[model samples]
Target: MGDLGRQLAYWDGAGAAKTFTHPVEHEWLAGVSRAARVLDYGCGYGRVMASLADHGFTELAGVDLAPALVARGRALRPDLAFDVLTDPPAVPRPDGSYDLVLLFAVLTCVPSAAAQRELIAETARLLAPGGLLYVSDLLLQEDERNRARYAAYADAHGTPYGVFETSDGAVCRHHSIDELRSLLGGFELVRERRVEVATMNGHGAQGVQLLVRAR
Candidate 1:
């Protein structure tokens, strides 16, 4: 969460035009109670929250760092709750406030490993014991195009191997499976699946979705 000024500016400026394509597996959530309190971290414009509501899941709230994105979410989904996160990695709520936490395509936007760890820790703090954490995010790509970008950015900025900068002035990261497992060390894996997803720029990409329960 260090010096997120640039990322914040990018999202506040162009976030409204971006579309998140991470698929929410309703089947995975089938066992969850309809009344369970759910929190959608990095919920841009409430898209996933709306989908959850449509599938009969009630008591959902979303929080995002971008003001414009949160504003747009409130406008689009008036019934859902969306809050702007002025102090990130710290959602203002009591400990164990939520039964489920959604981390949809959020890690990519956070380029630093330390920041990602802090975010995950915050998510864990917000969840009740044995609560679920659903994560949908990009996996490192083997294709030449992605490889080249990864190398270029790593060489130029000295960021991690899978971290890269987009043409749209935003820095993002794709994670390895091992890295993700290390990040979620406190959680026990419940279910996992590999899926194809569209990037905000509409490019086809490989992604992993995980449903884990707090230990």
Candidate 2:
């Protein structure tokens, strides 16, 4: 297959699509109350959007790096709308353009930490005054095994995805939580938490870390 196949395999992997999503996380996000325009950056199969939509958050959008994945996402939800390169990606939205931008699990994908910073800056630019940005991803740690699954993925599709620094000749860059913080400077961090432990075979748990930048 290809990059899209790799992503789809991961998303549709056992227990991830069904058991990984946490309502408390969504409820916590909903606490922002004023959130109207939400951009699900790097949305894979639209699972989070589907959940948010189920909770009455209809003003939703999704963006992904892979066109094949986006195409598949459309097939998964024929009634919903999908967009290009994820929202606010290249030419980001106007300042305070959206009330909330969901960037969950997006930061860790890029090969370089610098790219992560650029992505974060764009995300910050898209936030409205009092708008919030939510992000979650695997944190780099001493244990190399933590990102084994991603490593495997990289080995399978590194060249096609255009990724660099593969642990085993694959595309991968695991960031620690502190590195994540460095990426989002404009927005004040209100809260943070680690959602999974690789030791627990919790890759499906998403290594969740939520940061909200208050307007």
Q: Which candidate has the top score in lDDT?
A: 1
Q: Candidate 2: where are CA atoms >4 Å away?
A: 1-24, 86-88, 142-170, 197-206
Q: What would the per-residue lDDT of candidate 1 be over residues 1-215, giving only the tens digit for each residue?
A: 55443488889987667988899999999999999999999999999999999999889999998999999999999999999888887899999999999999999999888888889999999999989999999999999999999999999989999999888888999999999988998899999999999999989999999999988
Cα lDDT for residue 28, model 1? Answer: 99
User: Which pairs of residues collide in candidate 2?
Assistant: 63-86, 96-128, 130-215, 140-175, 140-176, 166-170
* Candidate 2 overall lDDT versus native: 0.60
Q: What's the lDDT for all of these models?
A: 0.92, 0.60
Q: Ten consecutive residues with minimal summed lDDT in candidate 1?
A: 1-10
Q: Please report how far candidate 1 places residue 123 from its true position, in Å.
A: 0.6
Q: Put down candidate 2 lDDT per residue, 1-215, tens digits, no spaces.
A: 13222343343342133322433376567575533888888776676788777777867888775566666778888666677563324534567677888865565455554556667777777777787788766655444554455555568755312233423232445665565666666678877877763311244333657767754
TM-score of each: 0.97, 0.71
